[model samples]
Target: MTTAVLEFPGGRLTLNRPGTDDPSLRAWSSADELLLQEAFEHLAIAPDSRVLVVDDQYGALTLGLSPFSPDVVADSAQLGSALALNAALNPACAAPERVFSWLQPPVGTYDLILLKIPRETDYLDWLLRWSNGALKQAGVILAAGMIKHLPDRSVDVFARTVNVEKVSRAVKKARLITCSQGEASLDNWPGIWKGYDLEAPGARVNAMPAVFAREKLDIGTRLMLPHLKPAIESCRPCARVLDLACGNGVLGLSVLAIRADIEMTFSDVSSQAVLSARSNVETAYPDAKASFLHADGISGEQALFDRILLNPPFHEGGVVGDHIALRLFEQAAQNLSDTGRLIMVGNRHLGYHKSLRRYFSQVRQLDANPKFVVFEAWRG
Candidate 1:
């Protein structure tokens, strides 16, 4: 892959992909670099001050701000991996020890925050909550994105919560919004909510704006969810289970309710989804043992599990593609215990059956609706 040197305010960045054939589909948009440069030029970042970065794709902002005490936060496992790889490529900058998982911000207050407005509104709402909680009394918040991507309501959202100032356009493509502490109170912000009911009694899945199918259950997941009956005649004793690509965690939480013995792990590529799923789990099963992580499927940890459930995302950023789903299946196969089962719900057009058959000895159709299909494959 070709390396591009990006000249910025503090220093120059050497960016490149790992492999020649599999090039980066996207580069740090001009807006991303402009936002970082403008923030550094305008804001006085204290050397000892804590800095938080939200939705930093592939560590661009995080790496650019390496001189400061920057904590990188992201919901996508793929982005996280890319950050690590990029950090390794540029060894001069210190590698961040703690990357906060999706929707889970670090506990302490921060002096400054750099945010890239995400596509999901629910995710943005959740971040707003974090902003309310973590920003110091006089802390500064700066967010930027391409003008086209910035929603009309985004300005209203910032204005209602904090005092905001829009910076003059730098590259003609992006604009920066700087915010400061205001009289607005956190009590007013309604967290992202999407109305959906899980099969489990009393389990509701309301997603933040950024998650896929935030308004309701995705047709694919909805199709597969009904077929998730206990594999054993009676529910098996609690075991380790995972909900990969766990948008709102409807699937895992439902499983947790039925089999009280299972320890559930919910992971997704969206921080908002992680936050919503975490809240749903707490609301539905207060005493249940579970962990919520913002990850790209199963790439981060190697925890073996008895059962893995997934409603894997087939598209990347709404573009119809199969790379993400294929990666999820491959990772599931690699992570499952010898006797573990990977059960997934996917769109029928995606042809997940062929993918599952490649990894598992047996793959069977659990159920199907007109638009989606559920498949169960056991790891050999």
Candidate 2:
């Protein structure tokens, strides 16, 4: 694997981009570089300071401030792995004191919080609400992101937890927002949404912050459901089923709701998605034979599944490509029984049928709308 080198006043660092094998794709962004520069310029910390780093993309911010042994929080398992890899390469920087998944609530009061704003405004909102109770009275929160992605809503969410202290001038098309802890309490948290309606009667979904399609049904899934219901029912005596790249475990949970006989496995490369899916499964079907995996393409477990459901992601770290989905096809093929079938939904523009044809003996389109198509391929 190749690496990108970023040098700052603190030190020079080498790291890999999240979810990609290409070395040319620089891991650290200008926003990440600016955050480090601003932190070094404005923030002071003790060796044992209780600091928190949220959404440190590929470990730039986490490793930069690692000398303080700050606790790190991230949603993607891939990000966590990259951080570990980069930390190993940079021996001088101390590893995080502790790593927290977004599924878990913020643990202790932090004197300084470094946030890299996420794409979803709702996710930023939830993070800020949680930070309200996680920061000390005199704590400061510093957030940075590309100017194009950061809008008034991002600042509004930051203000929810802290008083806006300053907004940095745009540097390299990125900017920083400095905030001071406010008097907000935890009770006012705009918490997660639970019991959202599902197509299956009496089925509900509990979505945490940052999970894709958390607020409402995604159009692709909406299009796929019409075909999934029948495919799931026809693949009878399905002792085991795997929901690949399961987000919030909605696809698996939906199947479990319809066919209670099947043992379901929800797997994703996201810590937050795994945790959310586990919680959603346990809450709805306490006796359900469901397992949640934080895995990259079914690396370790043994049993082959009778069916695999996938709504494979087309992008890795905001870079659009079918590489991930194609990999999923190969993995799904390897994990299926001789009689097993893979049911997947994708945008029509993705041309997934060509990949499906390469992996399975028989492939056919199950359903399609203007923008999305559901395909089923059977292993022989």
Candidate 3:
């Protein structure tokens, strides 16, 4: 694996994606270097302090802070693995006190927070809310991202939680924003949205800016949702369900609304999607049994499910790739109970049917539109 080495202050770090094919894909980005410099110059890292590092990508911020504090929070399992692998390569850097593999905030309050803006807006919103409640009054929140991807809305969201100040821009296409605690307000912001009355209620769905097509339903999902009726009808009442790549929990929400007695579980790689799904599930089915987890598909669990609903992601970060979606399918197959089914929606051009056939007893097209198709794969 190719990795980029970053040197600053008292530490030297190497970053890389575990098992990535590209040897040239180094671990650190220019933005990462910029954030490192900013942290060294302005942020005070106390030996006894607990610092939360959000969305550190390949552990740039987490590894960088290892010397000062080992406490860290990472939202992605893949990133967490990469961080562990990199740390193993260099035994000198102190390992984090605790590393969270999911999107949920770390358990305790912190004195300092280092945030690298995520690709999703909804995740960013959830982070702001989590930080507002978890950060101490004297703590400082420092965030950085490329100027182009850093939305103005992020600044607005930060303003609502704390007093924010933008620091000088770095040559590496990045800028840093510092947030200080202030008179806290009730974080009433809805992390999930559930359409009720007109739409079936009891589907807790939250939105984060990072959720793909968050403001509105994705066209692919819209097309696949109708096909779910057949699968839902065929499903046993109150069957255990899994919403693989559950996005904002739209598919799962729809399923819950129709089958009120069914139990649903939502999973997604994006922290924003998980938060949104959790909120939506809570709002729509307050008393219903359902849980949302931040996970990389079926990697977090081995239990088989009766049904799995998926709108798998076709890309990984900025790179257009199908490895993630393919993995989701492979795992879904391994995790399905006997007589269970994996119902998914995908673009028409992608040859997922072949993949599904390899894993399931039968793979059939449930429905189709101009650009997308809903597929069903049953485990014998």
* Candidate that would win on TM-score: 2
- The reply for model 2, stretches above 4 Å from the true place, is 21-24, 42-48, 185-188, 234-238
Expressed as tens digits, the lDDT of each residue in 85-124 for candidate 3 is: 8888678776675677445456778877778776555566
lDDT per residue (tens digit) for residues 322-380 in model 2: 88898889988898988889989998998988878888889988889889899989866
lDDT of 1 by residue, 188-233 (tens): 5556466676555566778766777766767777676666665521
Model 2 C-alpha lDDT versus the unseen true structure: 0.78
Give the candidate number with the greatest lDDT. Answer: 2
Candidate 2 vs 3: which has more lDDT: 2
How many Å off is the CA of 313 in candidate 2? 2.1
Estimate candidate 1's alpha-carbon lDDT, on a 0 to 1 scale.
0.73
Model 2 clash pairs?
A: none
- What is the RMSD of candidate 1? 3.6
Which stretches of model 3 miss by more than 4 angstroms? 1-4, 43-50, 100-104, 107-111, 120-139, 152-166, 178-214, 236-238, 286-289, 354-361, 378-380
